[model samples]
Target: MWHFAVFLLLIYYLINRRNSKYLLYPPGPYSLPIIGNLLSVWMGLKNHKYHHKLWQSWSKIYGNILGLRLGLINVVVVSGRDMIKEVSSREVFEGRPDGFMYTMRSFGKKLGIVFGDGRPWSNTRRVALKYLRSFGYGTRSMEVIIAEECSELVKLRASDSGQPVLVNQMFNISVINILWRVVAGRRYDLNDDRVKHLCGLVMRLFRLVDMSGGIISFMPFLRHLVPKLIGFTEMKAIHASLQTFVKETIEEHKASIDIENPRDVIDAFLIEMLSNKENAFTEEELYVVSLDMLEAGMETVANTAVFMLLYLVRDENIQRKVQKEIDDVIGIRQPSLSDRSRMVYTEAVLLETLRLSSVAAMGIPHMALEDAHLGEYLIPKGTFLLMAIHDLHNGDLWEEADTFKPERFLNEGKLVQDERLIPFGLGRRRCIGEGLAKSELFMFLTHILQKFNLRIPHGDSLPSLEPVDGLTLSANPFSVIFEQRSS
Candidate 1:
């Protein structure tokens, strides 16, 4: 028994030594055999609220560019602006990881813009953007659609005057309506059960993805052996439901699509599909792409808006200042994209909210398509790369990073763009819906502040700014009393 134990230990040492000769992976925590650093990483991610901070802490020990092994995959996390810029600029680092989680979510293949990479992603993104622009995505006409939803939102809130309400719930439908108008050429009624169900599924899908970590992502065999233990079953059900919803919408569009004059994004995509049969333009891919737009469009902007409102409610002085700006600039009229230039303080507040919350936190992980050099480290082909955007948002790059100071984004009372603030991410994989999202956020926020004063419910104490941990950082649901502001 003693001889056998010694032999096994010798074999393990030799294997590690042999593997180390080929790849000079960056520094990371001590990993265990087979499992590597999965257990420790899982523990850190389990605390979702502090996960980004936890990654930052790890970067302190492992340096800005660090590497870890999660099961069979080599994971690299890049921090700070300079190092992140170095990694993101390389085309070799543009691939999306084909892990179990990514594959499963994208219908057993790389299908959509979010997780899909290479030719498929490029093709779909080009078509989507072109059509979206043609249909007034970033134009004044788009703001008209958003402002209509904002008006409806104000009316909805007014109907329940003096009641404590979950501000996200109020904003969710309005935000979704904006995307729906862009994507499907129609909007769902706020009370529609179909919209509510789809929203719930989208939220659940993100939560499940965040919770599982390596178990569902890297370890595929475990999912089959113990689906419930690793949340595989639940995630599959949500994905299936979401896919069905998107498919139904696509089919409905097909039946009514006018090839001559495209109505919305889906119709535009179908028109492109007719022209480019050789490309990755398929009905199934369209479903996934449309679903991606809907999910990202509604969730990120709405949550950020809610977080900004939460911060404003906590600081009445800030709220008053923002409202005063809104009142002065566009009094008693719907705020437009044209008015955004004059609303400097409001823009600053939104920028600060994005910086502090870091909604997507790490953003989506990038995969190495070839052996790459990031600074002094060698990232082997197929390795996963994650940019610590949260760290950049909270790093030494900003003064008083912990405090919620919108003034950081203001230069001499004018809103100035900062390169360091990358909430929508950067590089080839930067969010395509950024233009639409910015429009929705600006219009919705200006409209709300113009009409109402968001305050904590009469009996409740001010809620903490600490966000709920998930795929995206979201404020814990809190009731807000929307008091109609006196004219």
Candidate 2:
């Protein structure tokens, strides 16, 4: 038994050495025997508070295409605008990294649009986009849905009696309702307790799982050995809650089905599940996909809206400028989708918020389907590709990258379409809800500013601009007094 175990270790070492010799991988910090650069990355995260910034610091030493290994898995970190674009567009770099966390979220298999790869992902994404669009996604009808929700939100905030409201999770239900109207054909009340609990769970999950996949991805054994200590228990509890919610919602939809005329994405998926014989289109897929839509849709727009408000509150001049634009174009009337184009400064403010905040700092990791050449380096097959999205936005590509200058997005008082400003990402795997998110941001921000003057509490100091880093970037806990504007 001892001889066999030793033989197995020798063979594994041989394979690792052979793979390294064959490919001239991108340069990175020295990798110790079995652990690789895992310690360095872990420490980087500890010091930097953000994976994107950690990778950016490494890129300075190793150049744009930095390579490393986390445990036995080979990984490559890509930075710079052109390099990231190249990786994103290439078909070979379109696959997603597989791990315990990816599967844990999707009922012990890769079934959803976010992490699923190969034909399953392509098929799921296609059907999702098709049905979502059919049900008013990215259309003018979505504008009405968002507008109505904005009205409800305004009413809720107005009832606060000009008190400072902590906005970290404030927009969760409102944003979720907008997506729910399209997905499940229903919206929750802004103050729904269950919705609030679910949103809290989602945010907790965000903080627990970073882009690097955390300890579970590298050492699955740790989960069993020290489950609670490594956050496995809390993560499992969150998933269970999410699964229960999704399961109940799907079951409810199943009970009331109108095959001839589907109500929303859920009804549409149920109809598809009945007809499609493929494994990808099933009841399980429906559950996971629904959760994906809600979690992805809710988090991005809500966090971004909060970040925008935070920035505006921090800089009163920018706030006044955006408000002036709103008053000039929207007047006393509610802002419309058509007003977005005319509100150039307001649009620039939104663009700058996206650029600066970078909620999804490190985007969903992509895997190399085959040996691919990224820049001058050879990215090995099965290597997980991490794009430095936050770094790209804050890199040398922009002048005064750290500064909150909305004018960066404007040229001669017109919104300039800069390819470098890819908040929604690029290529086939880019975020599908870009239009919906944009519309929500525009409507929510404009609606709030139109009705209220956002300010810090009466005696408190200015709220910190430093973001709470997670799977996404979120503003630290801060409150805003929504003082109603005089008519």
Candidate 3:
């Protein structure tokens, strides 16, 4: 049986190699059979995180585009902006990965605008955009909530009395609170047992994603084998916990849904659930959709906020300028979302933060649906696509791209938004939470800065800005003092 299994795998690789027959592709290191390029690629580096220098090194040697084998999948990374746009085009890249994410799925039957395709995705995206437009995504009405959260951040920092407080916890609390209200219609204490457990589950799920070798990804049948063969008990436990949270939220929404008085996301989903019987979805879809939203909405925002906090601490000059912008525009009074436009420097700071952190370093991996030419390269159908967004963020496509100058994003020092600095991605499958996220960050960060001056603890130097190993890259354990500013 074992001999046959090995034989079958060898045959599969031979076939996949044939499928990868493309001459226009960028140069890559030599690949070996069975293991293809995995052994050589991973052998030298502990994991991809430590291998950051590898990407830069490879770019110098292999041009902007390169190919490698990620398990059974063929990963083609586009490093150049032209290549990025070419791949992101709807005609070339139409499909997405069907990873373990599909198997562990649990959310509201409605997929958040993030992962859905066809009509389901369209409906969710349209509704979300329309609803956000009305409720002030980057507008003033929504800024009230952000102001409150930032106020809390300031209060928490002041409580430290210039002592260093680990912002990982604070950052998580603020973003989670915002999402809690926006999506779930509830907020839990920062130290709440369930909140802590949820964080743990999210952290573990991300870890599983990070170190998840290509073992089971190639074949779902291998899930059982890989877990037992590799001991993925903790990952399973994390999935179980996450699944439970989604299930509980769904059940709660089902019980308390009011058709006429829809408020937060739960009520909104429930209303859609009850009103549309024929075209309606089931509880399973509901659970899965909710899970997707929680993961996308919460994960990115939390990571972005946390890193921005760390960056502000390290770069005190930027922090002071942002606070000055906030004070000039919003005054001692709380900042509403509308204030973002009035405060150019504050908006620029947020943009700079997004650029510098590059939290999702390797943009969400997408899969090609058909054979297409991206730039000069001929990409085959079903090839996995990962763009070097970190490089793009650092590239000269935009003025002052590498510099953390908010002035570049401003006109005569007035706040402005440019689509070119696209951190949320572009086209149809772009992040649905883009509008809400910008609002959350802008309103929250400026408000916090206005009330507290963020500074790294003087005792230890600031943490290096090197990326982490997980799907979401964050500054490693770093401490910052949030000294209160007199009103």
Candidate 4:
């Protein structure tokens, strides 16, 4: 009876919402009346592993923006640099797409501020940026935390007594401590069970989204009403774990409020939450907003570092270039912000790493809040524009863009920036934690390389650079030797 009812509902929706006649909706390969191009998307997506092929397949036919549907919802995939730049520039399409994955995993409506659009996102972003700067995000204080975490990581790896450790386990603990410093204001050693719990929760949340088959977007009604009817069983466990962790952290901050010297992000937010309960800061906003930084900051950073090292282990030439640049600039010592400019090739390597291995393959989806003109199409209000960062990164608008040639970023042996590759994204909805993510990647990777060279496990072949599916393109496990680098 329930299945029949859902079928009837889908049929009803197909008739009413299946109209893709809008001039602005952009044309693509056809979808079924009810499913609306989902099968087409699934067909092109390889290994359920590489979903970028879905965008690549359609983009080959439809220049930049291609529209498809995940059941009832219409999705516009922005596949080129021009389309992404244009759509992202529009304030109308500035908020995160609402769904079960975003809600349950991203801390929607619980203690985070990512769901809402328009004035609310703007206001929250403004204050949050201020708080981040206050917490010394780009300064030495932030670097100090990353350094501390790296030290703990070294100690833990060293305890393995030269045996290669499965980097996923070790790197995750290091990543969480960095988040702890950013959000909670304290650094935890590897021995801390809290660090272990943080990693566990992050992985659990990742798994929920990974297994969903885009069904959360397809069947929002099921998730909103009967979650069990859908496949988000682990979601509840993930929610409870994350919520408890966040609530406890925020409460601990409340108990130990220091008006004199605010140390961490929580302390700064606490001051704001206490002062402005009405306008800029609210109790709900503080908890959830901090939750946002915690979640977004950790996952992306960790994934990126892991990918960079994974690539470095296989592509020894690139790794050697990075190390040579680091050594030439900062010497045999640890890298510092002062060495930031001097480390030209290191900087280039980082940029190329981001470009080749974009953490968010199809970046985050942005929703149109108001109708807007985009090229030959006029996007209506409430439409979604999913930016295919993979296309933008791989496209050869720049020479030899597909290959991981770090030198492409260095003109005449000096580092430069490429506006074409917006890995952290662009415009109002750009990642707030960009600065910290960059810092963590640089510090963590350089620290590891300075001490040990990353190589594929003995007798094991180099791992493929192809990415697995999820919100981010995480490189799967490839055994490697963390052989000590010569002094």
Better of 1 and 3 by lDDT: 1
Arranged by TM-score, best first: 2, 1, 4, 3
lDDT of 4 at 385: 72
Candidates in order have lDDT scores of 0.81, 0.86, 0.67, 0.72
lDDT of 1 by residue, 1-487 (tens): 7578557755774586468523577888887666677788878766643666777788999899888877667788889878777677779999888888878867688878888899878887887888778888878788889889988888888888689987765677788888788888888777788788878777766666552245677667688679988878988898888888788888898898888888899988888788878863888788888878888877888788888788888888888888899889989877888888899999898889889988888888888998877777788888888889888998887899988899998989888999998888777888887877777778878888888888889889888787876777778878888899888
* C-alpha lDDT (0 to 100) for residue 29 of candidate 3: 76
Q: How many clashing residue pairs appear in each of the predictions shown? A: 0, 0, 16, 5
Residue pairs in candidate 1 whose N, alpha carbon or C atoms collide under 3 angstroms: none
lDDT of 3 by residue, 1-487 (tens): 9789879888887776676464555567777766656676666465444433456456667877777665566667777667777667765585665555434443312244544555665666676555445434545555566667777766666677588787665666667776566666776665678876687577556645442224445444566666755325666677678888878877787787777776676666567667898876556655656666667666788788887787777777888787777777878877777665577777777888888777777677777777777667777777777777777786667666555566676778676666556687766666767887888887668667777877767778766776566666666778877777887
Residue 473 of candidate 1: its Cα lDDT? 75
TM-score of each: 0.93, 0.96, 0.87, 0.90
Q: Give the C-alpha miss distance for residue 423 in model 1, angstroms.
A: 1.2
Q: Pick the candidate with the highest lDDT.
A: 2
Q: In model 3, what is the error at residue 2, expressed in angstroms? A: 2.0
Count clashing residue pairs in model 2: 0
By summed lDDT, the worst window of 10 consecutive residues in model 4 runs over 204-213
